[model samples]
Target: MIDDSRTRVLARPFPPRRCQALFALVAIAFLAAPAAAAVHPGQAELVREVARDTGKDPAALDALLDRAQKQQSILDAIGRPAEAKPWSAYRPIFLTEQRIDDGIDFYRAHRALLEQVGRRYGVEPAYIVAILGVETSYGRVTGRYKVLDALVTLAFYYPPRAAFFREQLKTLLELPADHLAGPLDTLTGSYAGAQGWGQFMPSSIRDFGVDADGDGRIDLQGSLPDILSSVANYFARHGWQAGGPVAARAQPDAAARPIEAKDARPQWPLEQLEAWGYAPLQPFNPGEPAGLQTLAGANGPEYWFTFGNFYVITRYNRSPLYAMAVHQLAQAIEAGAGPADPAP
Candidate 1:
């Protein structure tokens, strides 16, 4: 759970986006960007937008923007996403033995709560644990940047996703108290400005966050029930299938049709992929909906059949590598945790 009891909340501006930890901070030649030393020219426009959408005082909202700093580190980090790595490299990062073991331990430690939430949401307990495991290392390292600073920097300074981050910033401000991880200024997670154990952005918190503790608020960082249930709700709402296959290794022969790496959304039947020469190592219903993914593995080219549930995992962070990592980690945790235990 996120312990923000000692966190000092500061005022920050509002707008929109979704976030998860998808990058590592890397040194960049252009790290010396100017700080948002004063209110950005766009801050006024943002304030107007927020005020119009949230009914907050314009002067108060503008004051929050004044406090939000533009951090150069965020710029550097966003410029170098870990998704740029091949699957062989990315897999090792999240699928480490230590991470898998840690996921199992987390599930066992919170078995009753995790299982209870799983039953309530029709999501597997292990999947919930896997998401927390991958997103923030079982809540051990959410991030270091103040969310306000990260979003402010990205929204005003970064051009590529400025429009998206600007909207995220506004959504953060407009979020109800119940949807926040903690005090506005104290919120922090990932270079992308996500918050809490699951690394959710403002819009995710608003739309998908769950008030699991019956405390009238959703605190993803400090409340395991909130974090676990929120993650499960996100999957369920996005069409997660209970007890369905997640992913499997596939064997593509020399005569296999060449396929390009693209979006992991399932678009073909198993029959189509079979005709294309991609065969799963594990038998699957030939009529099953599946997506084909090709990745560079240590042993050479690796093929995978990702089901609807796997695609749902990608909705959280849209990388096939990320989804596969979560699926494998969840499987490992399920095996380690043994049979399901009754909720205490």
Candidate 2:
């Protein structure tokens, strides 16, 4: 999940004639600028590729690119994602009492739908709620950036992941016209171009979004059923084993090797980890794959035996901290605590 503070712009409605005059001036300014002055280097190639893929006219695609502005803030935010923070820092941000309470309310409000979807998709209700809670705070903060602007800015201006964002941009462009809420350019989402309660990227939405209410449309922004079911569906598709363990607390052996780089995926058998001087507080299948993760806690270090389900959670976001936050938050909400209550 990409997190950033929202920005609000207030504008008084303009008279029709004044609006027309303002638009005319802006159009003139754009026309007078040299093409290179507005278009990012390689943007033309992106436009051509999108046009070829989507059967859109290249000039029209170029014009759309011309309208997209480079957002330095997006670049800045992407540079230091929450995953980069230490576990002690990142956990508190998402595991706050307020978020946990909000998650409970969200779950209670949509209990039936969540249960139905969870049963159908073989995912737990708490996990579904936790994913939404972490991603957008139960839709309270779905972001404020126009998705077109964010995608274009990253697709052209951010070289590190330009190819990936460009593909996302292409996916956005190819969305079925009827699947969207409004004009493509006006759609708003996170700086990373993740949309709706689940904060799904364009490709994810296309692959997993469902019309759960059967209203002949999939509206993630306004439809709780669609949003909840879509999240469950994503987990199911990503190989979330039904009724499986997610994680367990572990005591490190005196000779336990210190964890360096933590891999979210379960890569070693429980037997192997046991041999390495780490043991789970709860028994798990000895043959099952597992990974050891060490987190920097306020006191010192915290270790966890992450299971396959934990890896599935990481597929949503590749951070062990993120999965832990979601797991812990889900547990807290399941305990029926309010924001004022301490986590379980």
Candidate 3:
């Protein structure tokens, strides 16, 4: 049992980053209650909705709630903000020599599966490899929180975003009861509770999971084929255009006018971006839609003219650094620009 006293203690002296402390509060809420109790009104309605859609029984979902609540402490530990620090803080952890080496081996081991998914979905194998490399160090560490706990805590207790988590909760209860990683294994992850190799949310799993190995069930926790397939499926669903450019080094025309800052969609027209002082490394027709995302670099600033495909990568995680890391890692892995290591 976790020291409930520690729950009152912050993980660090620093203020919480990314609202991570909320995860701790969420954990406590689930832990304080019976996981198998009748669902909250919102959850009860959601369960009915899921049951109606999937043709599953609401009664069948009670076990999932219990399982979710059981993993609360583990979720609290992993969901703290330390792991989700900013790029300056996060970069050192992932871009290590060992990680780079393992990335190579991961590419080799899952070469066929990754390549196949890339071909089918138009997402590059290198990008997929990079994603896995960053997410779990090529599956070296998936997590220590039971996905059930993380989901339930966020689903029922985190009211700021209860509706979203509740939907994911509904998806979880309706999935095969046997889909858990193991009875004893508690899968760990970010405060938002994304799970498995790709760090997919339950809704995403339900919507995008695929059986790359031709298996009857989609399993992201244990199967490389399923994980790769699921990642590709997610990219495709987000409008990843095959053989299309993801991003490019661009030079904005000094004379170019800036586009009005609005709630811009990733699918915003590339031509429109070009009109706003951005020019690509190479010449291309202005018919494409792109966005200008600026990030902090080693020196001052780095800018990217991102196409629709690049936007699709952002769908994995909203952060520009996350997307850039995946993109750069893919390029490095494909070029074999770094040392190799054994696959995990």
Residues 219-262, candidate 2: write the lDDT tens digits: 88888888889999999999998889898888987999766545
Q: Model 3 residue 306 lDDT?
A: 73
**Stretches of model 1 off by over 4 angstroms after superposition:** 1-38, 340-344
* RMSD of every prediction: 16.2, 12.4, 13.5
Go through the candidates in order and give each one's C-alpha lDDT.
Answer: 0.87, 0.85, 0.68
Model 2 bad stretches (over 4 Å) = 1-38, 337-344
TM-scores of the models, in the given order? 0.87, 0.85, 0.72
lDDT of 3 by residue, 1-344 (tens): 66777766665465566468878889889899865646443556666687788887677654445445534564465456443665565556667777777777788776766777888888877777888888888777776656666767777766676788777766666666345343422555545667777888877877888767665767778888888888888888888777777777766666866543331245457676766677677876687767776655565545677767667777787666677677777777877734335569
How many clashes in each candidate? 14, 0, 14
Error of 2 at 197 (Å): 0.7
TM-score of model 3 (CA atoms)? 0.72
Order the candidates by lDDT, highest first: 1, 2, 3
Better of 2 and 3 by TM-score: 2
Q: Judging by lDDT, tell me the better candidate of 1 and 2.
A: 1
Which candidate ranks first by TM-score, i.e. highest? 1
- Residue-level lDDT of model 1, residues 1-344, one tens digit each, is 99765564433322232112212222232365564334775887888888998899988887777888888889999888888889889989999889988988898899889989999999999999999999899999999999989899999999999999998998998998778867788888888899999999989998899999999999999998899999999999999989998888888888999877578878899989999998788778899988888888888988888889999999999888889889988988899989766569
- Cα TM-score of candidate 2: 0.85
